[model samples]
Target chain A: MEVTTHSAADETQVWGGGNKPLNASYGKMMMWFFIVSDALTFSAFLVSYGFSRFKFIDSWPIADQVFTHFPFLHGVDAPMYYVALMTFILIFSSVTMVLAVDAGHHMQKAKVTFYMLLTIIGGAIFVGSQAWEWSNFIRGEYGAVETKGGQILQFVDAQTGKRASIRDFATSIASERTTHQSSNGIWYQDEKALTTVTLAEVKAGFEANPNLVIRTQQLNENDQKIDLSRAASLEKIEEAQLVVEGANLIRNEYGNRLFADFFFFITGFHGFHVFSGVVINVIIFFNVILGTYERRGHYEMVEKVGLYWHFVDLVWVFVFTFFYLV
Target chain B: MAADAHKLEIFRGLLKFKSNVQKIWGVLIFLSIVTTFEVALGIIRPEFLLQDFLSMKLLNWIFILLTIVKAYYIAWDFMHIRDERSGLKNAIVLPLIILIPYLAFILILEADYIFEVMRNGIVSWNF
Candidate 1:
């Protein structure tokens, strides 16, 4: 390949006196610029996450409670372990990618191929782990009862912080069904069906089950959990609301609605990036194995991809810290 | 010529950082320690520390500080930013540093306003 430098005045000048201190190639410079722009995009998402979190500061569902599921080990209240593992996988992949780039520098084709393969495996594992997390999130564990005031009242065992499900609290109310699917007399299927259990049904059930108690929206002065007083005024206030069944974007079994939204948006966005990154990596991997770079007498393409892989890993670090840790 | 060859060997040794194997292991160990610290802070949530800080909880502040440290190491060592020129590093990072915080501050302030409206307003706005 020919290396040429145009005069500083030239629009497409590859090198200039101002750029003398840093002797990086045009491609590397562009990659840095791309990374900066991408970082900003991620920052915007994270900042929005922070904003939402602050908006629902008092009632935001605790991260540990929301993401409590561990794969295979059902009912285990493992928090952040899966995400930590995912972080390790991505970071390890980044290490392998860097190693591959280093091997490329030394013209060690076999070593480069080996490290690259390992990197690909790591990426696949991280992506799989992410999918598992999404499944767990989408299929919520302990369902809650949403009030008319848009507050979720989740049942928790007073002794254990583990969430108490509706199954534990309320028996399913049996309702008679019509023979054919009709619109006028029966509720239309096309239109969204109202919740099966009204607040009245739930209240009656609660009254029947004296053991079952209410968890309120307001936190105590000390920010500790406050059990609802069986005051007549409170009972009247609670009776006026609705009882939502399933978890939607706006609401979840966990008291906080924003929790589900953030989980979906952040993880979904990151997952999409990982999917695209894998596709790009696959293309580059195939090209590497095919000796494209060897023919070109430069392995800078591998380095460029490695940069992207590292950036993905970098983003995960922040996500893990913000979403899982604090 | 002999001196030049010796110098080249020394340069290679420096690049290798005694052993690339040892360095990789060291980085992994360091990362684990940082993560452990973060988890420990979260689990423990020391009362004294909580009482001392306003808005900035000790656990949260620790997580943020550790996160910044991790980001620095990842950028400088893993991404080879430390090997790059100061000018290149500043050019890439400074804009993001400036814009991101500014955007966060404005958005968070707006979210605060929304929160106040939701809390105090007579009329209801669906969250």
Candidate 2:
């Protein structure tokens, strides 16, 4: 509340023209400033994710169950393995990027070029792995029924205590169901693509199966979905309104549509960053090969970009924890 | 032109590296170990970690803490913030320290309140 005016000498001492206050170049300082702001943006996204998770705290889909598919290990419950591998890939790329920067410091042109190539390769693989993960998520492994109240009722083999795919039990019921286009229905409206199985068929299959029990989205004390008894399962099936096969912006076989939305938004955003980082790395790698930095007598560009690459890796560390581990 | 202007010590000088390249690899190995441990704990979901503490599972707390540790090394070592002057380090880190937790507290607390209202209020959310 008290205003104290400093002398002009004090002002000049602080401003002190021709001095780098933080002892960093203008470009590097700006990169750090950009990173700081970007970090805040990412934190906002993650904290909102936390908000949504807390809101649906009781019914949030278990990360273990949702992300169980591993590449080439189909039908096996290998949760977190693929994501863990992705994490390692991204981190390894960060290492190479930093090493490239270190080599740049020593004026080792060939070493910088070699490490840059490795970093680029690692980044490409990481992006590829992410694309595969997105595909698997979009094409969900097991299908579930969506109740009229938007609750997800997943099928489980009670005897085995494992997930049961709707395809395993859904009987083929011939029905005159056609996709409604603008020409067929109202000119202004069209139906979305239909799931492989219809609700009626799912209901009929449930009636025919004695071993299948319905697991509600709600979690019990053990942090697992609550599976209904046989009679309760039969009763719960009556409330089913639609068959959900995979994830999209609207809904998912996974419980809580918000979960899928956040997953797509957050990871998709991070993946875009990785994509751009790879592009940036490729450009820098080319410059390194062209001896541009060598002729310039410094490799500050590589160091600046290395900061960006390492920041990307840092974000993934948090994303991995919040999205998968926590 | 000594790039060794960058410090060689990490873990508060408990460990020191001979070269920047070796330090990069050291941090990489450390991060990998943290990630592997996180994945293992996630898969196991040990009985003790399931207990609720401070409105969250102990396992979740561990995950968040380890994640912060990983983030620290990535920023401080890999990004060369440890080599930066203290002014820049504070400029980069202090705001995050003050603001992220503040935002998290407010938003998460409100979310929990909404959850309570949805569970106990006149409107039935679960059918």
Candidate 3:
């Protein structure tokens, strides 16, 4: 951008070496560019999620029924509350991050440190909440039977219209069923861990119970899952081939197996981002405490990292809307 | 590294905060309110919203639009994009503006077409 001589004509050019055309520091501008790219990456993941969701619009699991658990509120249908709280925590952390950046602008070292600490704590809490959510999803509340055609059949109490857990109804059968391991099975073959209850046990229990009805994955006019008649429930139970207890990449008690795959991939990716963001924030937090920024005559490092932290929160807003709210 | 003065107005200059810290908190309140509204709608799921609108539920459209609003405030205010010069802002936002919707539209439309084929064609998926 430098010209041979300092002249008015040369100075008129926006790219003249002495001035910033965008009026932002090189590092800050680069951070903004990085955020734009990362935003597109997240948009791709969410859009593909939408693609699969619409592809299986008729049979996709209802997010509410899947994520109804809240910490310390057992058996209560608290939907969207935990995710909403996570959203608030991340947003509040964003607020504190900005406050830290503003304090940095004013050269207030202690204030910056305090806000950074708050931001880190909030991020840690969010990540922990996500881990809990993952656990809840992996260890499903109500077990379901998977048909030979790969459709999930959930049981509901006809009297109350609430989900019925297999554990409550499945009769314990004294059998010698055991998980196949490498030592016990053929040298080259090993089976996955056995589910808590076998399919035969479930079928026998369903035959014994009169109040239980089978709920299909299909949604009705009011967006509720369709419950089959008692006779049809008996017939459907005959089609059961495997007992699905929770979600994994291959099987999900919730609904379509792809739902579990997308849930694990997208949210797991976002959780990883939050984890790294927290790590970066902690690194910067120590720098703030050590007066590194103070010695450098600027807190621009904190500002750049603040931009990234806020971007993570921004991505979560979309994830929350698409994954949970929608 | 020079600290520039921030533009304190939000909502197209309809609302203003006295200081940067105050603006941060104001945006926080606004975002929290929007999130609370979304969660409430999700839980209640009003009957009218269950109706299909342009092939998707109206409630979903509302959630997407409100999510965009939340994302805008978080990016513009919390990330200090609003304080940036017009050139910098455009440079950062223009590409996404042109690209994200294009990808969503193409993918979602194709997915719908696939759904149609699976429904109407000889192949039976719901066995």
Candidate 4:
């Protein structure tokens, strides 16, 4: 037979000086440590975002203009509303998660189950909203001419703050390029055909519609927008291809490319965390339902998983503030 | 026995919030208000404030401040760090606090250098 002896110091060391009567376990402590480390990792990402913003201080894309798209509102200007809703959903989930944890403390199994289900629903909704945002971003809105200099000059209305596209003002050209989709041409299956509407066609269209005005890449000395006053000058510049409306990197009809990049990197990362968190929570949830901890006469497993769920919620709070709110 | 009584009193005090639901909701509502304020300032950016602040724009500063406030609440309340032991809390948080700012400062300084190079370098690289 094995014999063991324990002292008061050992009891205190194992149980946190008896101050915490909640009877948390080693797994819970480790989870807290993991959360802190993960939080630091997220902080690094957000801080890098800030660094980049400072780098492009003068020409950074406006967040409102970039993230203005809302579901079922085709071409309607709605800014920050969708993201705000996502934030609310995540926060609501966090609340449900805490309620579940509180119920766990009291060993109310049914209440824990209900709150956990609510949390899962919230996570699903948030992930779906993110997917919608991604699809809209990838499917760009207005096409523009890419410059050899790699600089983008977007079309803007002088009278209104709305964006304009080539299709809005220009008609398609009769002339077509010689390149075909067959083996002879520069091709990799030719997934999509290039735009048939040439600059010449646009010029003709502009001439036909005198109400339309053209804005170019070049700015005057005062850093203000300049438009072509003379039809002849416009025609000449159109022929040379020197005054084509440039592509928009910031506040385009689709959205800002930087916004897409940040969204994918930051929120995608957070989403991955949430996904893993759900997987872990599901495992523990099943265990709780099966009464594994009940067999052992303790529910510490629930507390451990609860800590992790709360950590995931905490990270979302910061992401909401920096990405959506700020 | 006396020590046990003291620890119980401390535990009771920690759990003295009206309810877990109420506490969580209170934090969420506060966070929402702060976010709304940030968005409002961003949209209705007043002219006088922008003109006054030279080094850092008032709008940008406000965003940064609000962000910090949000971070603090998230860490303290949501993560339950406020209820943790002082030693454990410092062991985790203090290092992160020092290191994050240090890393941010270095990265910002480098970014500024790159900006200067782009602005004044002999070979023109237009943004």
**Tens digits of per-residue lDDT for model 3 on B72-103?**
99999988888788999999999998999999
Q: State the lDDT of candidate 3 residue by residue for A1-326, as single tens digits.
A: 86667678767774556687688998999999899998899999999998998888888998988999889999999988999999999999999999999999999999999999999999999999999999999999999999878999999999999999998999888889898888985888889889999888999998999999999999887777999999999988998999999889999999999899999998999999999999999999999999999999899999999999999999999999988989
CAPRI quality level assigned to candidate 3 from its DockQ score: high
Give stretches of model 3 more than 4 Å off: A1-16, B1-4
Order by TM-score, highest first:
3, 2, 1, 4
Q: Is candidate 3 or candidate 4 better by DockQ?
A: 3
Candidate 1 — what's its lDDT? 0.71
True contact recovery of candidate 3: 0.81
What DockQ was computed for model 3? 0.81
- Tens digit of lDDT per residue, candidate 4, span A161-280? 455666676676666475366576565655334444565665566566554454444445322344554464344334333223312233233222354466678888988887877777
Please give the CA lDDT of all the candidate structures: 0.71, 0.91, 0.91, 0.63
List model 2 lDDT by residue over B1-127, tens digit each. Answer: 2587878888888989998888888888888898888999998889988999998999999999999999999999989988888999999999999999999999999999999989889997776
DockQ for candidate 1, C-alpha atoms: 0.44
Model 3 residue A242 lDDT? 92
Comparing 1 and 2 on DockQ, the stronger one: 2
Task: Estimate, for each residue in B1-127, the C-alpha lDDT of model 1 and write its tens digit.
Answer: 0111111112224544444444555565667778777777766667765652546467777788798788876776667676677789899879988998899889989988888888898985432
Better of 2 and 4 by TM-score: 2
TM-score of 4: 0.77
Q: After superposition, how far is residue A54 of candidate 3 from its true place, in Å?
A: 0.6
